[model samples]
Target chain A: MKSGALRASVQLSRSTFTLDVDIAVAAGETVAVVGPNGAGKSTLLSIVAGLLVPEAGRIEIAGVAVDDVAAGIHVPPERRAVGLVFQDHLLFPHLSALENVAFGLRSRGVPKPEARQRAAVWLERLGVAHRAGARPRSLSGGEAQRVALARSLAIEPDVLLLDEPLSALDVETRDRVRSELRTHLAGFAGPRVVVTHDPVEAMVLADRMVVLEGGRVSHDGTPAELTRHPRTHYVARFVGLNLYCGQASGSTLDVDGGGRIVAAPDEPVEGQAAATVRPQAVSLHLQRPEGTPRNVWPGRVVGVDATGERVRVEVESEPPVIAEITPAALADLRLASGDEVWVSIKATDVHLEPA
Target chain B: MTTPLPVRVLAAVGFAFVLLPFLGLLQRTPWSQLPSLVTRPDVRQALRLSILTSLAAMFLAIVLGVPLAWVLARTHIPGRSVARAIVTLPMVLPPVVGGAALLFALGRNGLVGQYLDDWFDIRLPFTTVAVVLAQTFVSMPFLVVTVEAALRSTDVRYEQAAATLGAGRWTTFRRVTLPSVAPSVLAGAVLCWARALGEFGATISFAGNLEGRTETVPLAIYIELQRDRDAAIAMSLVLVVISLVVLVALRDRWYRVQG
Candidate 1:
């Protein structure tokens, strides 16, 4: 991979919201900016792509000062070496798929034939060469998105920004296009940022995850680190983990309300800490039994919700526990609302993050 | 789910109110002598002049009105509503009033026209150019209003996408914005040409009905009405047929409303 970096601090004030964030991406890095709707995810990409002007701060792409408020320098979007694929794949409806991909080249003064040749190459590379002659309105959703991707990538941009590239596709098409996008991003040397509301997509396409909430960066780390120890409830919920914040000593975590959790292999976190345990790690039992598992609590079932093949049993224990059990296991245990049950979790299942 | 009987009767009355005049003109037309009537030297001259002036007026309106529409629709020019009202004033104003206003602006010894006549020796009133100018003055507002509405409704994100793809402002407008609003432009131009072809009051007021120079079909029809009503009816029937054919052909081919 070639060396290219994008570093920027963006600040904007709007009537509905204010966005202030500083982000950096080194060469060959793909960072997923994940957030719910209206969390400033698209705004961040827009600022980096020079589509929106910042109120303050600066942006440098590939060592070029694209925007510097104090220096009073701002490069127009057309001159900036940043490519963005909008959420809706805003391809030129009047142009063919190949022409849409060739637009950037033609605008930059490349010869017509050469630009078309290069656009064809990109279309083939993105697996949409057969549909190159079709206009955007005629192309399928997935095919249009692929053409949009090819169009952006054809510019050989120093920084690439994708705003929810797969959110428009159907479930079946999403998976295939996602993997294809991953392959393309892996080969591109530029610093790439993919903004998506789906944590699953972030995990699949990004090297690092940056979670935004209400226009603020709530968490930034590797996918594993974020999933293992989410700092906020949104992040924890996003990764489907049960998180608790309390005080921790050598091997035990004192639950804020009542019960104590013992850690099998505890790290050196002594004060305020958080522990995340996957719902799959907790098991339900008919009665108080279990010798191997250290943590056990008796609680009544608050709710039983089924998602996909697994049934989630929410137990109102001391700190409240969610246990994922198979439907067969659920039927065997006859777990329903207001049913008494015992939940057991191995201490090793709890991953702690020291605050 | 069905229209009331009274409403249907009112609609038919409205339709007949507009169609009756054309039917009356067709009935009065001298069918056997139509060829001779149209081939009269004065009628032939008026036909050629009317076609020339209307075409010229349509061309001028397109060249000037499209950009004005863009400014009105896309830019944040202060007092935009006031500007739009002024541009569309000719649409509603009496054609003779519009002609008088043009004379005040462009006639010899008039405000700007005095200097034009003194310095450039270009006397505008009662000339062929004045006929084109009068037609353009009355017809341009239609084009501007239609094109402006089209421009306002175009998706601006397409232009943003073009900019991000490295196309500058002018290139984006030429390649993306213009093409997007082309159907409206064509429709506006056709309407403008039709209005210009039928202009009578403004042309007579601003550009007097000269023999072969400034006399258009409408002016010729007005003149022939005083001498021979059959010739006037013949000319009116020709205009009605031409307008119907042009409008139907254009709407069917170019501007068919999408479902």
Candidate 2:
């Protein structure tokens, strides 16, 4: 066990679902746990925070065993030096922002004057010192989020856990608070775990990302790695790439569900491989085009969605493909839903990963 | 939208049914004698005793009922539902029956009372303490029910947040849970106090209505009605005013819960 590290391998079972995961984070590292609802994202945070006990697991924080099921050791939540920032902030409605931040210090036997002094410093660092006297009900969403962050940080715990910290804010406030959170998280020396369903938040806030799907880790990698070679369907969609798995031999690949795509990877392909093509790498044409591209197929356009300056066109073919094109290209092709279109992908643009 | 004519008419009749008794009391009140009647020494003594006993009952209810409310709201003890039913039984039981039950359990020669007398030389029946006990017996359910409902509705995530922030169970209860339901506790105490102020059947049965001891305003009113009707009407007017003040004070909280 490394000093100032968090290591947890936990398994819990319920009537409807089961969660099994192993995660570790070194000091000064932030890991984002991203998953769909009911994927045990919040459950993982709860277990780490000592709010929920795992039936079988060992959790070590800063080289101290907070929970070891086999050893019959389980430290209660109050005894575990863990800071948790909830999705809704959950600030004490009766307390001022300063008192909220001081709560942990006071509970730990810090004198009231010293607690208030330290709390004031944290509130100042979070840029909400002026709002210290205000109750949570009066603060704006972003202000409340900052206070919640400060309250958690004030305790100076061994590990920091944020469960959708910016999810309760409005879209306008969410962007600013997320950036501010990134700065604060970077400043903290402890291991940090942030749980979020938003891929962008995970990518922007965390040094590495863990994809939890159906209560198990499906993929774990850096943002660039995840974007380049997404392992799961959810991740592929999140990265806006069309992915396929199939048998690979030489430069030709036979995709599952009756599709064929030619791929040229940096390494030679073997028996089983996964291929990913960015939406931008795919192209749509009204007629079959003569080009150096190795992969081309005719398919009916199933959906057309306008996103900002570009449009995403989903073509219903064998191993369906999504192609992103500019509005000018869309107009040039005269694309619409249910229209027959030809899809093309260059062999070099199809990235492969070992299955 | 305007209410339907039939509904409005029926509501008016219901409202009148509730208001007619107050109007009758007012009509019988001798305005010239009301001041002197209320200032009489016996009336003053009963009034002061009523205030002291009712306030004591409210305080005792809070000290004991809040913890009971928390247990009912948060715990999963066996037979919790049955325990809750028993705790709230006083709300539905007749005040006379509750008084009799209290007497059987706590009267001088009664079950627990005999033990108290033999071991501690404590006699509870027909005392000022008995008056407070009877009032608490009949009114504490109001407090417990209100606070329990508030605790049930509070977002427990705040308590979880407190625990994660290093607050122990007692600290979480004191700093988070109790303050979150403060308004409900206050409203419950006010309701309990009002109920205790008007207590007659319970005090008469258990405490025996001793002047300056257990003879609260309600008991005094009952006694005055036979000998001095004017004094009874004056005391009834005082109670009516107090009830109105309580209603006004609780209007916002009541509507918030109802709405």
Candidate 3:
């Protein structure tokens, strides 16, 4: 089998916003669509799932053309064999967990006993076998979502549509559930699309990540590619890179707001562009250190906080920076909130992107 | 003394309006004449007629009304609003007007009756069948509106989920939809039955209240109030008791309403 493929580009025109995008995911491949609040990520998922027919688009899922308005080839959601797991789980409140999972089988003409048996296997795989007899209201959020996953998988759908699967969980639970979801997803051989605003979920869950900004693809690459060079402020913020727009002619580059800084000549920029550097790339010193570092700025610490095992200092430097230092380094430097610090970073850490 | 003030007031007023009138009927009843009055053939016939006609009317209403309610609640057809309006017209229409309308449409010289008489010399007005029609026409909307509201408020996502699982539309409706809306359907059924049981004006006008053919308990009580007060009072008590018992029993059983 050639598996699943989608060459669909959906465009929806609303008075307030127009959604235009093209996406593809091969069989057994997980594609993570990530963006900011109004990035139309969910709208793209909706069009692929056949929940909303795009105002204009060609949707070919698993080699079947589902939405071809000109050819009158609009297959409804029910017939498309594409499973949609909603943000809220959307488990039928009236049905027991076992029944909820068994429902997909019933719809597919499987015998009742056989359907229940198959659903039991799915529930067991998700480690919710004990909760199969309970109602959705009685189950916890994580358990209900597991049941929803079982319900969707019971029919053996060609494509799985996951919208913010881990977004509803508490932080601790999100990590555990995302790992468990990864295990289950790895076992299933189908094209899957997961939507999320969290970079952690996207990078950890998807095989190939696609970023949508302003209803268009700003970047398409692996999780590493986006973190390496963030063209937009949204991606820069996500990867914890300081982004600045400016003019760069040679070793001495004057950024629009952050004053002048040196960038390599080999940096690619043909027009208006941006430069990004990770806070970790900036080395903090108690005094103005003398060296040939391409970027070095002095600032008084504004705030200090410990996150996880690292102490992060908020500084009031030109084009301000947030530097993350190990607790060992913090203790050695005896860092304080009002301490004056010089931040030095190597030239290679600075990434350039056309605006 | 410490009972909530609202609760105490509610109990006092509710008992006065609901139970005191039946108590007054019981107090004024002529116990010696009760047996003979009820045993009389005319009273027996009217009681039988009332029970048969009201039940038939309620049954007929449910058969047509439930589907209508489902359509109004689910579909967005252009004329659906008008259809719902037309279904409710009879509920608010004056009983005499509805009776007269039925007569014009199905009476001996009326459009439907004219055709019937021309073909088989048959007509609907002034018959037992007419009594059922009159009661049903005046009562069906109560059932339809109640069920429609229930269906409208129900979560439709469950139905969508069922379809995604592989169940067709009809199966989803039969197994899931109907069970989900069962409570409302029962409530509507009870209301329709009560309305049909109490139906009076249309039954008299369209069915022509006669001694055995059309005289239900309401008409019987009316005629006897002028000729025989004791018998009329006795029958009034019977009708009131039956209505109370039916309402209380159904509410408790279906709606889980405490006494």
Maximum-lDDT candidate: 2
- Summed backbone clashes in each candidate are 0, 0, 4
Candidate 3 chain A worst ten-residue window by lDDT: A262-271
Per-residue accuracy of model 3 over A212-323 as CA lDDT, tens digit each: 8888888788889888778777887777777777776644556777666656647445556677878787789998778788788899899888866778787887867778
State candidate 2's DockQ: 0.86
Quick one: RMSD of model 3? Answer: 5.1
Per-residue lDDT of candidate 1, residues A1-355 (tens digit): 2357999987888665788888899878999999777889988888887888999999998788999988998898999878899999999988999999999999999999999999999999989999999989899988999899899989888988999999889888998888988998998889999999887799999999999888889898999989777888788878888878789886678877777776765456688877788999999998997598988889999999996689988889888878888999988998889999898889889776676
Q: After superposition, how far is residue B160 of candidate 1 from its true place, in Å?
A: 1.1
Predicted structure with the largest TM-score when compared to the true one: 2
What is candidate 3's lDDT per residue for B1-259, written digit by digit as tens? 6999999999999989987877888998999988898888888898899999999988998888888889999999999888889999998889989999999888988879789888998888989999999999999999899889989988887776666556677878876787777787888888888888888888888998788999999988989989988888888877887888988888888757211
Task: Give the per-residue Cα lDDT of candidate 1 at A236.
Answer: 82
Runs of candidate 2 with Cα error greater than 4 angstroms are A1-3, A264-270, A285-307, A314-316, A328-342, B253-259
| Residues A223-332 of candidate 2: C-alpha lDDT, one tens digit per residue | 89988888888898877788898998876778988899898887778778889898999988888989698998999999999856899999999879999999999888
Q: For model 2, what is the alpha-carbon lDDT of residue B222?
A: 92
The two-chain DockQ for each candidate, comma-separated, is 0.66, 0.86, 0.38
The alpha-carbon deviation from the true structure for residue A349 of candidate 2, after best TM-score superposition, in angstroms, is 2.9
- In candidate 1, which residue ranges exceed 4 Å CA deviation? A1-3, A246-271, A281-308, A311-353, B1-4, B253-258
Question: What TM-score number comes out for model 2?
Answer: 0.94
Better of 1 and 2 by lDDT: 2
Find the candidate with the highest DockQ and give its number. Answer: 2
What lDDT score goes with residue A87 in model 3?
A: 79
